[model samples]
Structures are given as structure tokens and as C-alpha cells.
Target: MQGLTPTESISFILVFLEGILSFFSPCVIPLIPIYISYLAGNAKQVAEDGTITFHRKKVFFHTLFFVLGISFAFFILGMSFTALGTFFQSNQLLFTRIGGILILILGLYQVGLLDIKFLQRERKFQIPLGDREANPLLAFAMGFTFSFAWTPCVGPALSSVLILASGTGSSLTGNLLVLVYSLGFVIPFLLLGLFTTQVLNFLNVHKKFLKYTVKAGGILLILIGIMTFTGWMNGVTKYLSKFTPPALTREEENLPPEESDTASESDSAENSEAKEEPVKTPAFDFTLTDQFGNEHTLSDYKGKVVFLNFWATWCPPCQMEMPDIEEIYQEFDKNEGDIVILGISNPSSAEYPDNADKSKEEVLAYLEDNKYTFPIVFDETGEVLQDYFISAFPTSFFIDKEGNFFGYATGLMTKSQIYQALEQALAATEQPSE
Candidate 1:
């Protein structure tokens, strides 16, 4: 989530808040007593005044087990969405459209525009609540299994969160966001379980507010569906970017190295001092082997431009833009080593689920299959990628002949983008002293 923008952070916040609101939804608020009774213990003691006998410790223990079950269910769902998002990185437009469509359908169902009976049907796990023994494991299973029950209020929120997760294009980030959203839901459920007497009374008094809250959730779902469909989330973030911390953008990538907000920062003093004005970013030096086990080093290519790229074979965008990268490399004067293009491959299955644990032979095979002519190196330890603070795939770093970082782009680059960065690096290398 290195590239997380203000808009995305805000989205996570909203999702979490929605989770909390789910507790107050009509379908859920009315079920509080059932949840409390089931989670606290099946066997209950009642007082003469009809006040349930409170066993706080037992309730907490059983509720914790229930929460764990809920976590397991949500975590898996979140991860699945994240993986799907990452898999569709190449076709983000298509992915976004499909995700948007799904959200729209769910939203329509919420707003009463589309009455899907299957979606409306109550599908809760049957735990045989009354007279049953206080079984923690059973409660846990109920919590996990019942997440798919699809109540009106929770359904919209769950679908909304899934769309948001899929939009991020990173599994770890998607998983974490979903977990935060789940926390919002779980906290309230836990509170209800813990303090049955107080909350039950509160729910009774505010009974009329429950339906309205569900409506509010539906409205929110509709709004999110629109944003997801139009890809306005990023647009909103871009608009607010000035007040927020620096973020990567395609517009920024097209600019010269001097114009990049992130690329200009020095990794070390040796790279160059970080300056408000033009300053050399410490040069990245590494000893890496190409697919042919040929040794290459930054120092070896001294007095030449290194168009360093961090990429993975599994990445769609990476694959999409590589042909352009190869074209640029082919035009370079390799005989004099005036310009070098080295693509550093991060061979991790987590980074590319479909292409994990790539060996030298596999890497070579992939390059050959693609007919790529540019030089390629495998970043086995992955330190090279982290050293560069790579926030996205298909990132490129332009190193000047002086071995200083010139400029970089965090995503796919056009042939013109590659040319512009090269021209800037060449210019920076020959920059005159004061």
C-alpha cells in the first residue's frame, strides 16, 4: 500500500464505519437478542423482573470464539477479492467495469429497484439456539457459516467492501482493508454480546431508527457503485492530492525526472543530497545476473544511461508495456554502452500468483517465448525492489551517466514516456556546474 492515496484511505475509513453501522441495520438490530443469547450461552438464567442474568466472563469468552470464526470467514473473502483484483491488473478497465456492474446490481437490490428473491432470502446457519448447550466451537462455526446469510443491510456493505478491495489491485492491501471493515462489524457485535441488558434497552428505544439506517446503507451502496463504475475514486484522490502526501500518477510519469515527486528523493547521501531544487538521488548499485547467468553491475556500466525497470512476468501491465521498452532498447547504442536497459524481474508467486517461484530456466523460457530482446535480470533476494521503494509494478528508474538517479515512473510507460525519461537523464548527466 505504499502508493495508497488519500481517497483510498478515506474509502477504507468509510467501509469500516459502514461495518459499525451494520450492527444497527434492521435485520441485525432486531437480531441482537438472538445473537447475545446464542453467543453468551444457550442455557440462560432469568430474573423475576425479566432481566437476563448477566455472566460477563462467559459471554466474553464465547463471543471471542465467535469473532474468530467471523474473522476467518471475512479474511478468506478479502484475500480472494484481492487476488482477483491483482490478477486483473492488466485489464483494470474491464475489471473495474465488471466489479462496478456487480456492485450496481447489489445496490439496486438494496434500493428496491431490483427485487432479487434469492438475494432477499434469509440463509442463516441453523444453530438450534434455544436449549442447546454452551458450545464455543458451535458458536464459532455459526459465526463463520452465517456470514453468507446475506441480510439486506449487511449484504450491501459486504459487496461494497469486496468491490473496494478488488479496486486496490493488491491482495495484502485488500485483505487488510477488509479486516478493518470486519473489525467495525465485530466490535459492535462483541459489545452487544458483552452488555446484553444495556444495549437491548437501547435497541428497543431506537427501534424506529433501524429501518432508516438500512436505507442510508443502501444509499451509500448506490453512491459507491457509481464511483467504482466511473473510476472516480482515483479522480477524487488526485483532486485532493495537493493537501495529502505525494502519490504516483500517470500524468507525473510523463514528465521529466525533475518533475517526479517520488523519483527525485535520494536513497542515500552517496546518491546525492535531497534538495528542494535539482539534486542527485544516490545512485543504485547492484550486482545481478541476467537469465544467461551473465554478471552485470551498475559500476560496470559507468558513463552510460541505465533504464532500470522493476517488473514481474505475471503482471499484465508489465507485459503490455514491455514491447515498447524493447523497441526503445533496440534503438539504444549498445556497442558503446551509451544507454542500457535492464529489466529486473521480481520472481515471487505472491507478486504474480500465476507465475511464482520462477527458476532461471523458466525465466529464460518466458523471455524467449515473448521474443524479448532487452536484457533481463532476476532479483532473487527481492532486496533490489525494496531498495527502490517500488510502489507499483512496471516501475522504471532512469539513472544518469554519473550513476545518480534521474527520474522514475511507477507504472506502464509509453514509448514517448521512455524517450522523455532518457532525454532527461542524458541532460542531467551533462548539467553544467554553477
Candidate 2:
């Protein structure tokens, strides 16, 4: 939570809400009584005069174990999705398109707009517990087993959320999103543990409402798919960011300039001196000016690895990762020539007709307001943007010491990821020209 942005917080909340909705799916809700009965075991007591009671302590413990099992399955699923997201981070635009379309289709299926045979098929493990007392272990196993049972009903909503998880910038955030979702889904179960009899009765009486849950979930998924596919989620986040607290500075946390300089010197000294044959493949070189009126040409920095970040002021992901970039820039001693971090932008003009249209003055003021010192060069003619084939807002290219195009990663990257990328670029041999 140290650097949780307003946009991230909002996204987490939305995911959590989706989890809550999943719990109310038609498959899960109508059958709650049977599940609770199995979990409750011998805890239930009945007396004359139609009175009923449950051993709250025993029931709560059993339910706790059961929910934990569900959480375990959910966590594993989240990790898988997060890993997929990381793998596809370099082609985020394509991933977004595919994920969005898949979610939208699932939404339609859920809403009865389309009938998908496999989605309707139930695949649950048969665990017979007839005339047997349910212990904590049994409850836990059953909970875990039943999670698969509920999948057919919850798949649409859960899959949609997982797709979003796959698009997150880091595994930590992605896992946390799943955790929040699990909490939303399981909180009701925990509440049922505490008040088993009342909850069962209430659900039974209001069973009619359960049928609507799928439609509502479908609508929600549709909205999410549209937002993600069109990249409008960032715009919404940008708007809400105005209401959040101002950005916090991490100056005290960063390494001092002297120490950073010494580290850079050590890194350079330790790097391999035996040179391999240089490849003729060269990066597209261009001349541009930074916000501070400093002119930088790509070919001038031949012996240093360059982290070239293409970004725009209007891009939320770009803005989200700037602080991390700033930290790297400072830790590498600002522009010491061993490793250079630079940002590339294009102001709105006929040459570059796109959503990012902030003039040079606006870009400067924005940078000044945020106190970002990393050098950003303006591609006035938009030639460099085209040369790079930038299909997304926050694409980055790594250039090796020989001025060869090393590699590129699309979307947001954490500070550690940036460091790893720089190291790879520094260690890489010159590539053959295409």
C-alpha cells in the first residue's frame, strides 16, 4: 500500500466486487443449503416447538477450513494468469484485444445471448458423505473439491476477472487482485458459518433472485471487456485520479548520488572487456530536444546501453511507471553515459495525429510539476514513433552499447524489471543488422 495509486485502488475495488458477484451465481446460491448442511455436520441441534440451533464455534471452524481450500485453488489460478500476463507483456495491445474479445464472448454466454455447450456442462467430483460426520479436514477437502464443482457456474465471471489479472503489470498486484476477489467471495461463507440457520433460511426464502445474478454478472463482464478492449479503463482511472491524495515523494528512500556513481563505476569495470564481433544492425537514429532544451542524438551515445521509453502525458500506465523510471534514472547517476534512460514523446501535430496531443509547453509543465528529471526528447516530426512501430502508448526499446536494437517490452514495468532489462542490454553482444 506504500505507493498504491488512485487508479490501482479503484481497479482492486472493482475486482473485489466482481468476486462478490460470483458467489451469488445461480449454481452456487441455489445449492448453498446442501453445502452448508454437509459442512455443518453434527453441529446442528433441533428441539421441540420448531426450534433450531447450531454449535457456532464448530461450524465456524469447519467453514474457515472450507473457505481456505477455495482460496488455495483461487490463488493457484491467479498465479497462472499472472504468469501468462507477464509473458504477453511485450505485446500488450494484442493481448488486450484477445482477452477483451474472450471476456465479451463469455459475457454474452452468461447473459443467454449465446449458448455455449461446454460452459453449461458440469464437471464436479463426486464426494459422498452420507451418514458421516464432517471434520475440519473433510470440510477443507470438500471445499477445495466443490470449487471445481462451482466452476461451470462461476467460469464466466471468474475467467473475465482472471483475464484482467493477466493484464496487470506485476505478479504481486495480480495476486493481490485475486486475494481481494477471494475475500469478496468467501466473506459471505464466513458469515454463514457464524449464522448458519438464519442464512440458510433467508437464502431459501429469496431463491427467486438467484436467477438474476448470472444476467447481472454478464452485464458487468461486458462493460469490463469493452473498457479494456478500447483502452478506456485508463481514461476513467485518469479522471478519478484527480480526487486521490497527491503523489508522495521517495527522495529519502533513493540511493545517494555518490554511492550511485561508485556502483555504476563498479558495474562498468566488472562488465566483459573481451569484445565480440559487432553486428551491422543499427537502431534508427534521430535528433531531438529534451524538456530542458538539451539536444540528444541516438547515434552520439555509442558505447552505452540506452533504455528508450516511448510515452505520452495522457497515458495512465506511462504515468504510473514514471516514478519507477525516475528512481532508476537517479540510481544510475542521472545521465552518466554508462547506461542512459530516456523518454520519447510526440506532441499533437499533423505529423502524429493521435489521442496524445499535449503541446511541448504542456509536457514541460507536467514534467516540472511532477519533478521528473529524466531526459525526454520530443519527436516533432513523429518520424521516430513510426520507425519504432509503436502500437501502444508505453512501449520501450532497449539499445545496446553498439547502438543495436536489443529488445523491447510493452506496457508498464516495475523498477526491478527495468534494472534486469538494463543488465541484459549491457551484457548483450551486438546483433546482426536486419
Candidate 3:
């Protein structure tokens, strides 16, 4: 609930400038004229002579609704970030570390150090020109939907802003931050729509140099990510702390017990009523086809320690964990046959609904492009996915040398965590069985 500090006021100006730079990014700038034309319903306005013949009123109103639509979308995103931060307030430091690493990767991708092709894939939401022109409502809806298609530059900048907004400890503050960002973003578009011909001329004249805009944005994004990772904001935060007023002192007293806590203890006793029962399970086995057409059966790898990972190329956590998985798997030679790693990617097991419909060819290409040396499988029918009951991507299960179900983890795991799991699985191989 604190107001903006001097440093924050300065940061907001930078955020706004970054928004302008995002407007000039390669993905968005070239398409600006088309968007203007679509909204104005005046394709001939920016013709060879740069006539600027569009109806001013129509352009202004259309662009206004468009701006409102995207701004609303951004506000909702801000609320979501605030809610997420609230839920993880107890673990904010850990949450920040994870966010920092992700932002760093995105920065690297933006700078061309990493070529994550999927990140560059824009959502192809092409509304028919006639449809938009015929109905202004459709034009407004187009603007609303287009907000979801955030380009690479805007994505990282917005992410950084959301991090700051979330730390404000108030949902209203978070929403305002996004509104400010959208305001900073929407102003340029409004201007460009008003003066389409001149803007196009300016853009065309400076087309060659505009390429550096994205690079510069990428560099700035990288710095923000580094600052976040190293907690460089602390010094600035310390300065801002001086402005905060002291709270009136209150008398201390013993607090009453929470009902939910008492109820939960009673509930725990009731829940344990079924705990006396034990169920026997049979050994799990399944086969899947590798990318090269060879079949790998779990039964075939019996008596060897196995690291079974379920992952998808589109999953960021899956991608982040791959390097460590590769390193650990490489430690044991395949020729030795004592330790093995099997990566299973099922089309039907895609964790993200947006990435669910990926083609077999795409999956294969991604695997090959990444140059992963471990055995990979494409579960075309998802039969393996069914047998394992997997609903989350980047899930890992370790099987002991005796092929018993040793341990399993849901969601992402760090390199050290995976190694610890490995050590536990290795230890499982030595202990006497009951």
C-alpha cells in the first residue's frame, strides 16, 4: 500500500520508454500500418503518394476501443500476477529466483544467444478484412483477442513490470502498474493511427536502423533480469523505506486458536481412519517408439537404475531441466547398461492445452534441433501416458535396479534435486528387501 518512490517514479519513466521501444520492435512496427488500415477501413490512405485520406473520427473511435480492449486485458494480467504473489508470499524469494531465471532465458532468446523458435511464434489470429470493416464490434473484438498475441519484446518488459507490481502488496497497485504500462503503450498506437501516412514514411525511412531497437530492448531486459536475480532492488527499496510512516504501537496479547487449524487436526484424525489399509501393486511396464523408430519397453530395462522423464518441448520447465538431465545421464555410459534415461513425450500428454495439438514432425524437429543425445520417444497414441497416469509435463520417476516403483516427483525439479533423487535410488539398490 505504499506510494511510488523517487526511484520507482524514475523506473516508471523507463518502463514507458521501454514500451515505446517495444512499439518499434521488428515484429510490431511493420504490422502497425496494416492494423491502422484495418481499423480505419482505409487501405488506400497510406498509398504510394501517402495521401492520408482516412476519416479522422472513424480512426480515432476505432483506435480508442482497440486501446481500451488491450488495456483491459493487461489489467486482468496484473490482477493475476498480484494474486499469484499473494499466494506465494511465504516463498517470495524462491518465486523471485525462478522468475529471474525464466526472464534471463527470455532475454537471451531476445538477444539471439538462444534460438527458442517457439517463443518467436506469433499467434496467427487473422480476422477477415471484410468482417472487421463491416462491423465495428468485430474490430473491437479483434483488438481484444490480439492482446493475447504479445510479441517477444513486450512479453519480457511486461513480465518485469508485473514483478514490481506484485511486490506492491496490493491488488489495486498491481492493476495500476499495468494500466500505466498500457497507457505508455497505447499512446504511441493512438498517434500512429492518427497520422498513419507520416508514421509509415518515418518507419520506412528508418527501416534499417530500426533493427537495433530490438537488440537494445533485449540488452535492457537482460540487465533488469540480472538486477532481479541479484536483489539489486534492495538498495533502492531501503531508500524508499525511509518515507514509510511508523505504525501506532498496540498492546500485545495472546491470540485465540484458529478454527480451521482445530478443525484440520480433527479432520486429520478422521482422514487417517482409512490409513490402516494397504493395497498391493503389480510392476508397471510399457513400450514407446523412439524418434528413430526403435521401440523401448520398460521391461527391457529391468535390473538397471532408470530415470523416466515425461516432458514436452513446448514446456519451459521441461526445456530448463534438460541440460541437467543430459549431464546426469551422460555420467553413466550406455554401454555399461547399469543406468539409463528415457525421455517420453506424448502428443496426448502435452501439459499445456495451447501446445496440445503439436504435430509429430514438429516434435521430432525440436528434439533434433536441440541436439539431445539421450533416447527420446514420441508416444503417438499416448498408451504409455495412460499406463503411467501422467497429466503434468516434466514429471520424473525413478525406478530402482530391481524395477520397483522407487520414487516420483511432479512438476519441475532442480539439478541438485534430481541428483539427490538419483542418490536415493542408488541407495535403494543396496538395502536388503523385506
Give the per-residue Cα lDDT of candidate 1 at 229: 64
User: Judged by TM-score, which candidate is best?
Assistant: 1
TM-score of 2: 0.37
Model 3 Cα lDDT, one tens digit per residue, 220-324: 656655655665533233233233221110001122224423443464355346343211122357777888788888888777778888887767778898888
Off by over 4 Å in 3: 1-283, 348-357
- Superpose all Cα atoms of candidate 2 onto the true structure and report the RMSD in Å to 1 decimal: 12.9
Which model, 1 or 2, shows the larger TM-score? 1
Residue clash pairs of candidate 2: 281-433
The CA lDDT at 255 in model 3 is: 24
lDDT values of the candidates?
0.58, 0.63, 0.55
Residue range 166-241, candidate 1, lDDT tens digits? 3342445567778888899889878766785555445445757745654565666566556656655333322332
Which residue window of length 10 is worst by lDDT in model 2?
A: 121-130
Q: How much is the lDDT of residue 167 in candidate 3?
A: 34
Each prediction's TM-score versus the true structure: 0.40, 0.37, 0.35
* Model 1: lowest-lDDT 10 consecutive positions: 1-10
Report clashes for each candidate as comma-separated counts.
4, 1, 0
- What residue runs in model 2 are displaced by over 4 Å at the alpha carbon? 1-280, 350-355, 430-434
